[model samples]
Target: MRKIYVIGIGAGDPDHLTLQAAKAIGRTDVFFLLDKGETKQSLVDLRERMIRGYSTPRRRIVEGRDPDRDRAPADYTGTIADWRTRRSQVIEDLIAEHLKDEETGSFLVWGDPSLYDSTIAILDEILGRGAITFEYEVIPGVSSVSALAAKHRIGLNRVGQPFQVTTGRRLAEGWPEGADDVVVMLDAQQAFTGHPDAEIYWGAYLGTEDELLASGRVADVADEILSTRAEARERHGWIMDTYLLRRHASD
Candidate 1:
């Protein structure tokens, strides 16, 4: 039987790849890549750099065109479900044809695999279809949330207080109940702007040279974050940002 590695390669930093992740890379026989087009060339470059640095010399690389989906779909959940199924099929074909018995293949994920990433779920879906057979493992890496907290020199939660990690969609709906500190990810809508009184620590393009960071009460810095985010998105053609929102910073 073949094996698969869902290795967390960290958030755009070579150093962020843990030693264990390096070992996993060395053991991989094939690397499955999804080409998201030229707009995401930087991500492709990062993965290429890592494969060259840590992978075995004889390792093979394969690319598949990533399926496109509506970025602003009205039926968000249903759209994502369809997209994931399509993506799973792409990966399943790669594994079946390229990965041979007793060999290893890998998917280098950004941030920790257990975070908001879908690689694990996609693999599970592929297996559930019973078309492929491969034992798999996950190697954790530094998550952007942890990097954001570290960059801002603050802990995620106040002592003994609880915090929740949620998406911009949920945050836009309303601040979660029973959690004072909310870490928001995938906020294409700038939901953080709604909580004007909250203290916010924000970071964009984390773990890379073009990284940006800002912190202040939302009332004081919302415009700054909005402009900065817009400019960066325009410049890079993409952006991945996360923030920690505190209901009471003085506490």
Candidate 2:
């Protein structure tokens, strides 16, 4: 039997690596990285840095290209399912062909794997297929949401007020009912535009040297965020951003 560790590497900062994640790095004989492409090479670079700084000297890093998906596919769920299936096969091959029995493998996820990440789901699919067998555990790390809150010096939720965490797609439908605040993630479309009256705390490339943050009434800052996101994406070839929208009490 083989064992694997899915360890969250934190939002972006190497310092955000927890003791447990550091320990997991030491336990890994091989680390698997799913490369997202040249635009996000910084992410792959960061993973390499973590592996070098924390893992054992003799550790190995296995790189694989991530399957691409349509950004605006009509069949969103079906596309995602197919993408995951492809990714699972890649991972299964990495584990079966690369790792030896009783050896351990690890994946350094960006943010807590329990959040919006799909590594766990893909691995589960691989396990279900029975092509490979291994025991695994998750080590949570600081998420971009947490990094946003920390950088902005704001709590995710107000006292006694519930907040919803959702994607930019759902946010386009409308603000969620029953929640005074919402944390929007993976929103490339600047959905915050719809709620101009809401207050927003937005951050991009959080916890890294390139981090950009803005806050104020959505009407005031939405344009700035939009322009900034565009500039950042053009500059870095990729961008990861999250924001909090808080509707005023009177609204």
Candidate 3:
């Protein structure tokens, strides 16, 4: 039997690798990194750099292609189900080919796996297939939401105020009802437009030297954030960003 370890590498900095995550990387026989084509090659490169910086025990690096699923499917739920099935198959094949004799294999994920990451869910699908009997472990790392909050020097949640974390698509559809604070991730559509009255704090390429940060009322700074994000993406060929929006309390 083999074991699968899902480790979060944090946003974009190698230093964000947790001590426990580093230890796990060192012990794993193989490391699986997702490659989202050429545009997002930096993400894969960052993972490689982190492994080198830690001088972890020698391990093989396996590159896996991301299956870009259609986001605007007529049947969203059905499309997602199909996509996950295919994704699980690819992952299962990769693990079998690379870790046939190894007792433990690892996959490096961005941010904490528990937050908006599909790696664990995909792993579960693989397990369901009974293709491999494996124990599982998760090594957490600093999430982009935490890094964004720290970079802006603002607390994610106020005293006694509840917060919700969601994706750009959800925000664009409609601001989540009844949430005082909303943390938005995986946003390429500038979802802040939906909450024109909320205060917004945005950060891009966080933890990297080229990081960009901005904040203000959503109505006031939404355009600036979109413009800055586009420029940064063009300049760096890649960008990983996260933001927070809060509905002001009535006095």
Candidate 4:
């Protein structure tokens, strides 16, 4: 059976990579990368740097073109399902052609694979078909949620309180009942705009040289975040951001 390591490479900072993740990377004979496109080439470059810096000198890097996802699909769930199916097929072909029996291959996932990432789910689907036989392990690393808290110097949850992690779309529907603390990701609309009084700790392009941070009552710095995010996206051709929101905190 072929061995595969689904390693979490951290949010953005090279320093965020865990020793375990580095070790896993070093063991890989081939590192599989899903090319998102030229717009996000910086991401591709960073991954390349990490592999060069940490992995064995002779390791091979395989690049597969990512299947495009519809950003504004009218049927969101169905569209995502189709995209994932396409992605899984691409990955299946990549593995079958590029890797040999007893050789190790790896996927360097952004942030912890357990959080928000679809790589693991897609891999599971591929395995369920039983067309490929491989042993796999997941290596955990620092997530953007943790990075957001560290950059802000704030705890995710208040004492005796719980925080919910959600996406911008779900948040737009409504805040979770009785949830006072929230961490929002993949938010393109500045979802916190409606709650102007809420305290927001936001970070964009986190851990990279172009990293941006903003915090204050949402009303005061909401525009800053939006403008900064827009400008960064325009400048870099891409951006990844996360924010923590506290509706009402005890002083």
Candidate 5:
């Protein structure tokens, strides 16, 4: 049997690495990276920096080309299912080739693995095939949603109130039922613009030097967020953002 660590590296901040995550990095024999190419060079650099700082001198870094998929497919669910299958295949190959028996391997994920991330699922798919066997552990880290709330100086929920976490696509369709406060992620379409009456606290490229933050009633700040997001995306060639939308709050 082999060992695998699915460690959360946190939103873009280097200091977000928890003590346990650091120990896992130090223990890893191989770091498996599925490169998405130069558009994410900064992210790649940050991961390399951490590995260099914490891993043992004998540590090996293995690279695999990440499978690309349609960003705006007509059948979103089916497209994503196919994509995940391809990704599982790539990761399975990496583990089979690079991670040796009795050695530890790691996949450094952005934010907590339990939150909307697919690495855990990919690993499970590999395991389900009965081709490889490995004991795996998940180490949680801070998420961009927490970082966004912190930077905005707000709590995710009102006292004694419930909130929902969802995606931009779902938010664009309509506000969630039974929740006045919503945390939206993977919102590439500027979905906040749809809720003109709601208050929005938005953050982009959180925990990085290029971070941007803005908040106000959606009608007032929607233009600013849209334009600013466009400029940032042009400048960085990529953007990672999330927001909290509230139709009502105690404060």
Candidate 6:
């Protein structure tokens, strides 16, 4: 039987790749790269660059086409279900074609494979079908959450306080009931607006030389962040950012 390794490549920086992750890449027979279309071409390029820098010639690169982002349904639940289904098919096909004779193939994931990433989730479903008999291994990498905390020079969780990690959509729906510290990712609508009393430390393009950092009370910094994010996106054509929010006791 063959084994499939899902390895997290960390954020953008080559130095962020953990030793285990690098070793996994070096050992794999084939590598799968996700191409999230042209809008995110840099993401694909960055992964390629990392693989080139770290992996030996024994590993072959295979590119996977991204599902059509426009095809996503407006309904959140249905959209995710549909996307996952399509993604699983893509992976199944890729595996059959590329790894037919290989004992181990790997997929390089951005950030941590376990956090907010759907790669492992989709793969789990495919494996559950029992159509393919394969062992799975997850090589963890430094998540954007840790990168953000390090960039800001602050701990993610307050002393003796609980912290939560959530998406911008959830934050927009409403601040989670009892979180003292919240790390928000995949923010599209600037969900910080929902929390009036939180303090925020936001970073964009983390680990890259062009990173932008800002900190202030949420209410005061929210608009600035929104505007800056817009301008930054316009200038760079894309942005990957994360932020930490805390409801200060004094507020």
Candidate 3 lDDT, 129-199, residue by residue in tens: 88776778999988999899989999999998889999888888887877789999878777888778889
Runs in model 6 with CA error above 4 Å? Answer: 70-73
Task: For residue 233, give model 3's deviation from the true position in Å.
Answer: 2.7
Give the per-residue Cα lDDT of candidate 3 at 82.
92
Task: Report, for every candidate in turn, its global Cα lDDT versus the true structure.
Answer: 0.94, 0.91, 0.84, 0.90, 0.93, 0.83
Which candidate, 4 or 5, has the higher TM-score? 5
TM-score for each candidate, following the candidate numbering: 0.98, 0.98, 0.93, 0.97, 0.98, 0.93
Model 1 error, position 72 (Å): 1.5
User: Number of backbone collisions per candidate, in order?
Assistant: 0, 0, 0, 0, 0, 0
lDDT of 5 by residue, 124-196 (tens): 9999999999989999989998999999999999989899999999988988888999999999888888889
| lDDT by residue (tens digit), candidate 1, 1-251 | 89999999888779999999999999999999999999889999999899999998999999999999999999999999999999999999999999999999999999999999889999999989997789999999999998999899999988999999999999999989889899999999999999999999999989999999999999999999999999999998999999999996444
Candidate 5: the clashing residue pairs are none
Tell me the lDDT of candidate 3. Answer: 0.84
Candidate 5, residue 221: the lDDT equals 94
Structure candidate 3, residue pairs in collision: none
Deviation from native of the Cα of residue 61 in model 1, angstroms: 0.7
lDDT-sorted candidate list, best first: 1, 5, 2, 4, 3, 6
Candidate 2 C-alpha lDDT tens digits along 24-122: 998889999888888888899999999998889878889888988899989989999998999898888888888999999999999899999998898
The lowest-lDDT stretch of 10 consecutive residues in candidate 5 is 242-251
- What candidate 4 gets wrong by more than 4 Å, as runs, is 249-251
Root-mean-square deviation of every model? 1.3, 0.8, 1.8, 1.4, 1.4, 1.8
